[model samples]
Target: MRRRDVDTAVRHAALTFGAAIALMPLLWMVSASFMAPGEASTLPLRALPRRPTLEHYATLFTRLDLARHFLNSVVVTLAATLGSLLVTSLAGYGFAKLRFRGRDAMFRALALALVVPGQVGMLPLFLLLRELGLVNSYLGAMLPFFGSVYAIFLIRQYALSVPDDLLDAARIDGAGELRIFATIVLPLIKPILVTLAAYTFMAAWNDFLWPLIILSDSAKYTLPVALASLVGEHVQDTELMMAGAVVTVLPALGVFLAIQRHYVRGIMAGSVKG
Candidate 1:
């Protein structure tokens, strides 16, 4: 074979191996979810179940009340994602396009905040939420994610690539800032927004710590928190735990898979344009 062709073959082989290695655990989790009780922990470690069963899943929905937790995850993740996109996009556009006093200073201050560990602020934030009587509420669980500094910075960087002249022309034609943003700016920055949506969705969906801390009500628990509770209750029930894992992972995985193309395109576009 030609040298280039030989090199391409090696690279593809390496990538395939790496991909398989990365996916092995997820594949095993799915396979084990279908396994009968005690089958997953068997001596030989079977990749495929000896006998498939839906009993675990049924138990999760019925006895364990996982459906309620799943619904809570869906509601919180969607709300947080939408709110993040709106707030970040608007703030980013204002920073990138609109000139105002102290704008650069404010942006710099926010950028400095990116270096601070999120956990450092959690205690103070929780106390503030308690003062406002927001603790143990969905709003409290979602408040932290609604407008992150990193997300705002990402949007700002991407927004800088938008043409200033286009916005100026809109202003001359009697278009208000909000109208221009809705009609022109949003569509132009759609790729980045979709990327942000994917990021926010996954973050909110998989979040365990904050939700566990804020939501005192068991009925209001998100999937990860509920799954952790499952671990405590069903520690020896490996198959049951796997089933809950599958349930918790599938929606975020599906959302990412569905939007993966747009997600990649957005990242590349930002890297180049920003």
Candidate 2:
């Protein structure tokens, strides 16, 4: 019993250390955001603000017009999450349930496409968007993500465990495929959908490279792109940058926290079902 207790204590200690190491930067970012303008760069490397102030945040909102970028981020993220859910869920259902010639081969091709780097296609995608007159628009920034191979794969894998008999019964009762999917498959896969939404939201929130390339107008810049621009000019404003970081990170964190219980349950249930 003593030996077992010692082993458990060691494991807990190691896990605690790992958790602290991972979270330390985020904790410090929040702490530094509240510090006075020059206080964050002080000699002693303080973790807590000697005096907290929201001046930087005020500067961000009023002076820098960060709210525009914040609104842009929220709109884009929410749109992407909803759009991804609609597309990935339907595509996943088609893959998991629908029978058709070359279905397995088509899925294999999609899986193969994943090995190709996204950047390889960006040049052509940009040209295509330009032709569509979507350049520098929200649609341009969002176009690439309307379908995601990984998201489809995740949903398809989870959806495969749903009983096909339920679907067949609905079909035998003269129900359309859409009705069966909406009534039966969707409820059984709610947890995974929540998980997918969280992931899609976070990705859309943090995406920088594609948005930077597609959106040239400053007014349309997402939060991450706006933050990057801020850093270029405010290199010396450590506290201000940290404040921007806090604003950029908080929404994604909030989203994950809101869905964390569902995410956990989904993975657990999926594992058992699979």
Q: Which candidate has the highest TM-score of all?
A: 1
Clash pairs (backbone) in predicted model 2: none
Local accuracy of candidate 1 as per-residue lDDT tens digits, 29-130: 999999999998889889899888999999999999999998999999999989888899999889988889999999999888887878888889999999
In candidate 2, what are the lDDT values of residues 1-274, reduced to their tens digit?
7999999999999999999999999999999999998998889899899989999999999999999999998888888889889999999989999999999999988978766778889999999989999999987887777798877888888889988888888899999998889988899998789887877777788899999999999999999999999899999999999999999888778877887876666556545633
lDDT of 2: 0.88
Note each model's CA RMSD in angstroms: 2.2, 2.7
Looking at model 1, the pairs that clash are none
Number of backbone collisions per candidate: 0, 0
Best by lDDT: 1
* Whole-model Cα lDDT of every candidate shown, in order: 0.89, 0.88
TM-score, per-candidate, Cα-based: 0.91, 0.90
